[model samples]
Target chain A: MRSSFVSFTLNGEEKELLIAPGQRLVDVLREQCGAMGTRNGCGQGGCGACTVHVDAVPMLSCLVLAELAEGCDILTIEGAARDRTLHALQEAFVAEAATQCGFCTAGMIMAAKALLDRDPAPQREAVVEALSGNVCRCTGYEPIIAAVLAAAAMLARLPAAAA
Target chain B: MTRLRGRGISAVNYPTGMNLGGDPSQALIHATTTGNFVVTLSSVDLGQGLRTIMTQIAAEVLGVPPESVIIDTADTDTGPHCMGTFASRATHRIGNAIIMAATEARNALLDVAGEELEVAAADLETDGDGRIAVKGVPGKSISVLDAALAAHFKYGRTISGRGIYLKPRSYPDFETGAMDPDSCQAHACTIAEVEVDTETGEVRVLKLTSAYEIGRALNPMMVEQQIVGGSWMGMSHALYETTEPYYPDRAHGPVDFAEYLMPGPADIPQYDAVILERPSASGPFGAKGIGEMTANSPIPAIANAIFDACGVRIDELPITPEKLLRALDAAAVAPRR
Candidate 1:
């Protein structure tokens, strides 16, 4: 078995970890680096439960090879907050009760983050389209959509990086 | 016009506990030295907000704020027995147990508070703010924290309670085939409006308006969550989901979650639910079990809606477009009245 070392900036912290051939980024982040927030609902790319931000774009980490993330900046749910303060999206999720079972919350939040980072004020349809890839079985996606739109409005009113 | 519109309604009554009714759930509650009530139970939460609702129930019974109660129902190691989380019985069954247990603990607390305030236990009423006071005596009150501390140090007593709710098995008379099936019933009525594409045989549900009577809304938000999420599941069951779509030829069955064909956010319709809290006599503070019953009415409602649109009754689960088109074709080629 061929194993190689890969380096990436994860949640602002630089990390160099050993990876095996065919090891998925999700597995490395979970099994090797102990990032448990990135859940793997399905090993295949069908479910967006393993979504992560690679260079600020949401990518299904289950399909991406761990070695492919070398030299790239990655962010998981653990990094969504700063200074022990929750991000606006996270806060909005809590306020709206957007999660049930909480299995898809990390991916759902990441996908919503990707949409909000670019389009601060997205329509309900846009929010719906943005979260189409993430599968949440318990919430019916109503509150999640509300949380995203609320987070968008919250972001629009705040200074950059204050959340 | 390729698109045809239709409407349908369905009403159903769902039971709270198991049929025949012999299941039991238990709970134990004790106050910590800090006056926070800890409810010990083996009941599972499973994202249905069981812990939250149980905490609220305990707080209500103990006459304390919800924040002052902790639900320790993680596992069986340190908790009492429970009949598992099924048949929508946790809230109704385990909740009754908590009320019993908390009532006992409340009595014990009042006894201790009575001793401290030099009044009878019946004369002390807990004022929702964690303070036990004599009736009509505002200044003669003791904080729950001080009372709890005194219970441990000076009084040498414990404020605790144990509860269990057991429904006896109902024997049906062989003559009439009658028996008490469940503890209580929850009712629902859903009206589904849909559009059917006649040419392509595609069906789209536009809205689902429903009314539910679930005894009580202990936590209305969680109840609404169940109704919305369950309706989505019902819609999926009506037109999309099936493990045996080919019927005994399992080759084309869904192999993964993506192939399982649940309705995504894009497929969600305008879901509105109206809840009626008609309190039940056997429930915990009139709260019934309403976990997944909200999914029941929508299935038949959608089927009936499809029939109204095209005048074709497709009697099948996962009423796929092929089934609808075939039914339409069969109806068309057959002799009309």
Candidate 2:
């Protein structure tokens, strides 16, 4: 097995890690970076419980090779909160009671964040399309969809500075 | 040339709690030195908010705010015995036990406060905000924190309680086959509408409207979540999911999510649900369990909808396109003579 050193900006922090050829990004994020929030539901790219943002795009970390993600800007659910306050999306999720069991919460929030960041005023169908990859066995995706839309509306109302 | 639309409805009822050897659940409650209540149980919260629901029930019984109540679940070695989380028994069984335990702890708390206030224990009342006072005088009150401290150190009393809920076993009359196995029952009614393509025999669910008589909803949001997830599972089982493609052939089956079929976002239909609250006499706070029963009605409802859309009575698990097409062919030749 070949192992090499890889560097990437994770959660806005520039860090380097020792990675092997087969080590996935989910493994490094959970084992090395200590980001337990990024849950590993399925090792395959299926469940979407290991979703993370690479260059502000939601990608299944389980499918991404750790070495190939070098030099990329990675964002995780641990970074969703800023300055001890939850992100708008996280607040909406709690307010709407969108999370149950909390296993898929981080990935679901990260996916919603990418959608809201790209399109602040997404329609209901667009929100549904955005969350197609993620799987939430609880809450039936209705509250999650409502929470994402609520977060979008909240962001729309916020001042540019706060946003 | 055009798709045919049809609607169907189904109603189902399920018993709450498995009565195997008189299924029992136990709870332990104690007052912390910081004037808080802790509920310990072995019942696991498998994402259905069992902890939150149990905490709410304990707080209600203990006469304290919900924030002051903490619930610790799924520790079997230290916690009391629970019959596990299946059979939709977590809320009903565990809740009854917590009420018993919290009531005892509340009595202990009042005893200590009564001594501090120089009032009879019967004359004391709790304000649900961690305070105990004389029945008519709110001004002369002592914080629960002080009462707990005095009880522990000065009075040498540990405020704790233990409880268990057991349904009495009833032997079935073997000749008549009459027996009451469950303490309570929950009901669900689902109406499903679907569109079927005649050419491809593909069926797509358009909308689902359901009414659930869930005894009482301890947390309405969580109940609704369970219903929605259960409905999706029902739809998946009816139309999309199948591991055994060819029956009796064990060699071929879907191994992963890619091959296995479950409903995704694109397959979800517009869902409308109405929760009917009918308090159960035996359940805690009139709330019955709604976990497994949520998926019961939608399977038959979907099958009925397919039949209503096209007059093809395909008595099978999944109304597959191939089966539907074959049924349509047989119906066309016979044409309901």
TM-score of each: 0.95, 0.96
Error of 2 at A47 (Å): 1.9
Residue A57, model 2: lDDT of 93
Error (Å) of candidate 2 at residue B305 is 1.0
What is model 2's DockQ versus the real complex? 0.64
In candidate 2, residue B115 scores what lDDT?
93
**Candidate 1 residue lDDT tens string, A1-163:** 7999999999999999988999999989999889999999887888899999999999999999999999999999999998898999999999888998999999999999999888889999999999999998888788899899999999889987584
lDDT of 1 by residue, B1-337 (tens): 4899999999998999985547888999999999999999999888889898888889988999999998897788767989889888999999999999999999989888888888999999888888998899988999999889889899899999999999878889899998887999999999999999988888899999889999999988888889988888889889888665664667767877777878899988789989999999998888778887877789999999998998999878888888888888898899457
Poorly placed runs, candidate 1 (over 4 Å): A161-163, B244-249
**Positional deviation of residue B61's Cα in model 2 after best superposition, in angstroms:** 0.4
lDDT per residue, candidate 2, A1-163, as tens digits? 7799999999899989989898999999999999999999878877889999999999999999999988999999988899888899999999988888898899899989999888999999999998988887766677889899999999999997676
